[model samples]
Target chain A: MTKVKVAINGYGTIGKRVADAVALQDDMEIIGIAKTRPNFETVMAKDKGFNVYTLADRVGAMEKEGIEVSGTVEEMIKAADVVVDCTPGKVGATNKDLYEKAGIKAIWQGGEAHTLTGCSFNAETNYDEALGKDFVRVVSCNTTGLCRVLSPLDKEFGVKKARVTLLRRAADPGDIKTGPINAIVPNPIKLPSHHGPDVKTVIPNIDIATTAVKLPTTLMHLHTINLELEKECTAEDVESVLAEQSRVRFVGQGITSTAEIMELAKDLGRSRGDMWENCIWNESITMYEGELYFFQAIHQESDVIPENIDAIRAMMELESDASRSIEITNKTMGI
Target chain B: MTKVKVAINGYGTIGKRVADAVALQDDMEIIGIAKTRPNFETVMAKDKGFNVYTLADRVGAMEKEGIEVSGTVEEMIKAADVVVDCTPGKVGATNKDLYEKAGIKAIWQGGEAHTLTGCSFNAETNYDEALGKDFVRVVSCNTTGLCRVLSPLDKEFGVKKARVTLLRRAADPGDIKTGPINAIVPNPIKLPSHHGPDVKTVIPNIDIATTAVKLPTTLMHLHTINLELEKECTAEDVESVLAEQSRVRFVGQGITSTAEIMELAKDLGRSRGDMWENCIWNESITMYEGELYFFQAIHQESDVIPENIDAIRAMMELESDASRSIEITNKTMGI
Candidate 1:
């Protein structure tokens, strides 16, 4: 099988993880990784044997700063079959025109607005919608977490509505600048807080509302979800459905918090201690009458990595089936 | 004002906090605090000038261990106006016979089945229901949290149904034994998990379901609540109602997690960093169509402390009105 050449733009938190995940896939290869600055991550990317590329404008500056670069981002984009844009939110929107001019399939991160890609992608929720698309935006970590659980539940029993409270990590572990030093801050200070609308970009028909609160921790984002189902079901019934999904891992007894889940990822020797699966507490699956409730933890740094890889297969039509693509991604990334 | 004599029958997590809260009330006095062991808590109770009483069976054993005691649990029960049973779960059930025999009004913690007192109490939710009741059970921390928000929402807008996901702290900060060391464990591994039925013991007419999972942290429990309201409301509308309740503290921007809430309590010079109010993230208050959603932190150690104090007021008819009792308790404890 001919390997799909993939280029990653913006080698930051989500970008670097995607680069590593794409490296493990048998059908895809990381052709190059692009960044604007010659920072520590540029050095780390080079050490990982990834061909480092700089933005067209910053190529000279990067080389001047003693950073080795193989080529410019434009060169990488032109060479690859697909360009995954992991740039900062608004920057991804700016790069859309560049990928289009190169006639390359593009995958954008959730940080960008949905209009940038025209569709939000989740392997479990909207794999079919993304198949053969020229551009796809992998949903945010929280959205991916929600879709991973909601898609199955919505399919099995049918969702009347879903309400999710996102206990978000204030900043990424590596991010020391931004805070919530001594408080829980609401980002938008409004209802639905963009997450619910983001979910709709993939599962357009589902009735869902999300409220988010940023917390002090940097480990993981915990989601407490309540889904009102169309039909009455038992907790066992819901648990079994979620367990069948490849991307959903049922965390049973003894593992209590996001800290433990991250520790387990490290103990298992996962790359950067990234837990790609949605860590759903198995015992937390509860159903009363027709209402179902559970708590799941999202590894903010890595959950989207798997989805990005799946989006590559999805956009390329290398795997049109979600389960097959998810299986392959999980097996390769050890999700 | 004639002071109401209150005896606490457990010097553990909930018991210890309630003892200090009772000590703060001008209308109430901590007559005694009972313990079965001569542990650190017993010594701490004595240092706080609370008369330390020993369980009837362990009085001799406690004395032999060089622990000074004021009297036996039996004598404390006879002299007190109300005996608050904060013992271990089943132990409260056993102590019920003693309180009944002594003809003293009794208050039980949520750990004991609601049947022990046949009336679960929350100052904000069922303060009127508990007035003049011989036996009152102060609902669990999580239940008190749900009621603090739900009671007002239900009354103001009429909740059609409420579904709550409780991200529970695995154990108390002082508790070193109970886990989840490395996993998120569901306490009951079943639907509703006793919390829903416990809420019914206080608010019988409201349709609510609760699912609980234990996390590794000892900070506080986070509750993600979804309420299907009877009529459409705005986020501001919901926020205004929650802010009106004395036990519900609206956590606005700059506060991100329970850790910060606890720190704020300490900075405010609260005893043991006790935040008696349910710290609801004001930014998290959201209403879409007719459904309302929000995230709130329940201080598992001290949330029920105020509820216990109000239960004392209700059981004694010293303050039959919940608002009056809650106001007094909040002002006294600086909630």
Candidate 2:
């Protein structure tokens, strides 16, 4: 099989991780990476041996500042079979026309609106929906985490309603700017925070309500979830189903807090201490009068990385089976 | 009329603020403040002209370290008519016996469980319940904020069910050690956080469920509340009722965030930038299909300060009327 040439159009947290994951895939190759400026991340991308490209306008300026570049982003897009647009939240919408002009299939991150691609991709739930699609968006990290756990549960027990309260990280580890610094904010100050509606974009059948509170931690997003399953189930039964999934890991052996989870990742020698799996506390799993209650932590920076790779396979028709794609991606990424 | 002598058992965040509020009330006077350690706050309390007292065992050690003590906590309790126990959370329960042994009426902060006092005081909702009681526990800052708003609303519109999500500050501003540093935490990681039950202790008739998330904030707690009222009401109708309450302050005039609200307090020259009222966002007050939605910020350090003073009055029989006590507390504290 000819390798799918995947161009990563951003070298930040999610972008760089996706680039590495795609590089590990037997059926995919990193064509080039696009950087907006000559920052340390831009240099790091080049040092990692990925062919680096810059904005059409920044190509001259970036090279003038002693940064090497393969070509303009537009040139890279024309050469690649698909472009994974990770250029911040709203920037993906602006780059849609450029990909269209280049006549290339593109994958946008969860930051972009689902309407931008008209289809949201979650490898475990809706990979087939993205198959052969010209444009696809991988849902946001929180939504990705939610879909991973909720999809299988809904399929097994049928969800009556799922209510989640998220203790969201204020910023990614390397990010210094974003903060409440010392305040808990009802972000948007509205009921049913956007995560609930965002989940609907993927697992459209599930009844979910999410309320998110931004916190000071950069490591992970912790979710306290209460699910009223349509079918009665034991905590052990629910645990068995969750444990069966490749992307979910149960936290035990004295690892109780998010801090400990991150420490475990660091001890495991994972890059950037990334725990791509949903880190749910083993003891927190409880079945009280037919309702399931548990706490799970999502490594926001990397949980969606594998999904992005699976998204690439689905869009390119390289992998028709989602589990097969997920298996391959997981094996290569060592998730 | 003889002034009620109040003794503060802890000279920390809530304790110091309560002492100052008590000092401001015409019907109350601070007999002394109890500090476990001769910290900077201990010195500050002494410098502020509060008679600083320590544990009977620590009095010798504190005095050896050049700290002046008027008496032991037991002696202070004996002299005062009502002892406000503000020593950290579980410590109040331990000190319950001391107050009983001294044959003095006592008020415990929300840190203590309701069972310890058998009566939770909110001043607005259940001040009468605490009248002349031997032991009365003030509800938590979040609970106090909830009761102040919910009590008035439940009376005016009749609430069917109320749901609240609290973004709780991890620590007080003066606190240096407590932190996720950069994380949001599901405080109890359980369904219906303790605040709902805490509120129930004050207003048992109101059906309420609360979920709390701990954030890296030290300034204040932000609550996103959704209440289903029994009676149909417009946004204007709800706003007028809330506005009538003296303890609920509407945030308007471009005050969009908690930081600005704190800054507003500082600009107003409030002591330590304390906002004793629930700072509800004026624009967030909305009535949608019989459901009321709004955002309110609780100054965790000071919101309960006024309630402490009112509790003293109720327990001493200095004030028979709840509104009268609340009005007096509010006028003196500049709420």
Best by DockQ: 2
Q: What is the overall TM-score of model 1 with all chains considered together?
A: 0.83
Worst 10 residues of 1 chain A by lDDT: A180-189
Candidate 2 residue B112 Cα shift, in angstroms, is: 2.1
- For model 2, residues A1-335, the per-residue Cα lDDT tens digits are 79999999988988999998888889999999999889888888878899999887898878887888899998999999999999999988999999999999999999899899899988899999998999999998899899999999999999988877777887888888887666555565555668888999999988876666676677898887778798888988899999999999988787646888889999989988899999987677877545677889999999999999999999899989988999999999887
- What shift in Å separates residue A8 of candidate 1 from its native position after superposition? 2.0
Per-residue lDDT over B173-286 for candidate 1, one digit per residue giving the tens place of the 0 to 100 score: 778898654443445555566787777888889898776666656778887777889867888888888777777787765776777788888988988888888888787776
- Scored by TM-score, the top model is 2
Q: Tell me the deviation in Å of residue A71 in model 2.
A: 2.3
**Which whole-number lDDT from 0 to 100 does residue A89 have in model 1?**
84
lDDT of 2 by residue, B75-151 (tens): 99999998888888998899888888999998888888889988998888988898889899988899999999999
Give candidate 2's TM-score. Answer: 0.92
